[model samples]
Target: MKLNLTPLFAALLLAGCASVGSVDPAPLPLAPGAYKTTAANDATALTASWWQSFADPVLDELVGRAMAANTSVQAAANRLAQARAVLGSAEASRLPQVGVAAGAGRAADPGARAITRYSAGLDLAYELDLGGRLLHERNASALDVQAREQLLADARLLVQANVARSYLALRALDAEREIVAGTVAAYGETLSLTEKRARAGDVADLDVARVQAELAANEAEALALERRRLELETALAVLLGEAASSFRLVPATWATALPAVPAGLPSELLQRRPDLAAARSQLQAAKARVGVAQAAWWPSLALTAQGGGASSELSNLLRSGASTWGIGLLAALPIFDGGRREAGVQAARAQLDGSAIAFREQFLLALKEVEDQLGALTLLRAQGEANARAVSAASQALRLSDTRYRNGLVSQLELLDARRSELANRRAALQVRSAQYQTTVGLIRALGGGWATGA
Candidate 1:
């Protein structure tokens, strides 16, 4: 039997001439605009390291360490690498695959004859991509890689925010510890005065006992604050990829200055947030996948070339008379596979729809976070101011109470009460200030800080 390769070549050429299928771009569910909220002028510009606005060098260092060591950031980087490799693999489908082959063998007849044969050939196969299937796949893979890169960026931003928040908590606890220590000292002095008065019959034993109990409570509160600081340090250590027991965070005593928040529109969040950007890219990838799946419905055309030589002697295998070459076409049409192809297309369409929804959801969430942070900042600033004034008034009251007690004009109990109020107010002010600074950091994070605005 003789096989003619001409017809196969003609068919492949004809298939190449066939019109490529069209892929409709998926409709983006979210409008290409900033988010909207009831509050006007709530938008703020984002800085990349918004934490630096607090002017805490220790916090800056901690954030740098976490970015270098955080496991989640590393994981996102690894995922991006995987996506790039996948894209490379998809791209390879567009080029021809060629291979060389060689063989030698001997055969023996059952009766008496023996023969030797030698052969060698070059083989090639290429998908003509008549319907741009490989192109669609490559495009989808590229978009996936982009999406993964954005995901990595998002992870980094999250880690930065977490590290900053933890650092702020640690500083707040330190402030509390200081306040408690001062109160304990004040109580100790009051207890000493009360004890002397009791011995002199100027005051009752109850006054001495009351001062002692207050001192003990202040000491206990100090101890609790210490514990909280330690816990925060441990958390920060873990984020830096260190053993909590082995790592220690030095207490930061510097006053944190709040950074100015950039006023921006809600719609700016969509452009600034890496998570939102990644979500949009993923939606694009999903849309491209729909095209890839749809391409499955069209017939695929492939071209193959195989040439070889056969001879009784290995030396003559490459001779023209001993060599044969042929080209062939392979075509696959989906006849009926229980509707698998159709099902795949439908599934891809569903995935596209899901991605669109996810993108919109993410955008809206980002907007809400920014707006909420803005509102929180406004409230916190007012609270901080009120607390500051309260601290000042409490201090004045404590001083007046002390003078009155020394002059025998007020009871020891009144003096003790004034001291306690002063301590509470001071501690509350410290905490409120810390809260205000942390809220500012949150606003920066929500705004996507420096990186969000092309920093």
Candidate 2:
């Protein structure tokens, strides 16, 4: 039996066109603010651009160069541009497309009617978004643009952090080099004094030999420290997008203390971190994609219009009598596609699920980073204090040993040992200070300290 299917198709299309209210995912709950590992009061204020807290002009310059010339930052900017272009294309799809055509021709046929036609007119075509498919696509594209923008922001912040860390490392190496050089000089002097005493028969030859060995060891250490400093400078130069061979970082000896880091609640991280923002945008885009996929199960309607003129004479082509115009609507309904539409809907839902999970992961990682930095900073501070005390005690012991050797109250061996101990303590203290400063910088970066949304 033959059956009319137009009504059935129309009813299915109408049902598919029904609005699907947006699904709102629950906000993830964060831990309370009262969790504290130490008794020290937490600093409450966090800066978005925390690198400036160091007040180092050189560091500021390096960060600027990286932001401008770093290859990674450039790549991120390019991606953002691409995403915006895609968004513009999607928006344009929602508007009617128009075009103009003009042509001239002469034809002669041996048989029938030999006709020459000339036509000029504007043509228009518009897709009716009957089921909001185009709207969903446009919204998804816009969200993608926002996601790319946030990604670029995150990349810039990462580059800034890299430059700052590299600069800190170079400065720390410089400090270590100074410590090694001073120790070498002190060892050289001790060796010279032992030689003079040996010559005057006030000390044994073994005493002079031991002091000479200690001096040589210190010289080797000094050479190693200088080599490390050169390596660190090269690394810093590369981060600033400069040729390592052509670049030289002038060492700035700023012994300023590390700035205090502000520790807010874990919930604050969701608002401050760029990665989290990007993740949320990605989720929104995925959510919109689900609507776009669901809309595919419905029919699409399009309105098209065309007008033109044709005549043997060019003059007659402009006359309304010779003109032809027509307007029509086209509709398409997917009948049987071997379950492609259903598969698409399933894929879109899966993607939305993945995006949601990814957003939660980013949020949790941000929280973990803040906590790790906080604990590191706390331990580094305590270590710095203990190192300072050790340095002072070693300094006094070295001084006493030097006096005793000169008064013949102790051997050259004793003075050499004390000098070595003092040098080691000095180096260790400098290391602790360096670590403390670096950890504090890391904490500030983790807290989203150095960059703002527009900056």
Clash pairs (backbone) in predicted model 2? 47-449, 48-449, 48-450, 48-451, 49-449, 49-450, 50-449, 50-450
Worst 10 residues of 1 by lDDT: 16-25
lDDT per residue for candidate 2 within 1-455, as digits (tens), equals 12232343233222322232332235443433443433134443435656777778788788888877888888999999999999999999999999998998767767766677787877999999988899999998998998889889888888888788878878888888777788778778877877887899888888887877887887888788778878878877777778999998876686544566543333343365677778778877887889899999889999999998767689898798889888999999989999999999888878877776677677567657766776777787888899989999999999999889778798667877898789889888888888877777676666566323332
Candidate 1 residue-wise lDDT, 1-455, digit = tens: 12232343233222222232222224323332332322224333445566676677888888888888899999999999999999999999899999999887889868767888788899999998876779889988998898898889888888888888888788778878877888888788888878888899988888788988998998988888887888888888888878898998877685766565544443333465677667767767777787788888789899999999889987888888999899999999978889898889888878876775676567557656766776776677778789989989999999999999889898888888898788888888887777776766676666566424455
Runs off by more than 4 Å, candidate 1 = 1-49, 109-116, 263-266, 450-452
Per-residue lDDT, model 2, residue 114, is: 69
TM, every model: 0.87, 0.87
Candidate 2: regions farther than 4 A off: 1-33, 38-48, 105-114, 199-209, 263-266, 450-455
Computed on alpha carbons, the lDDT of every model, listed in order, comes to 0.74, 0.74
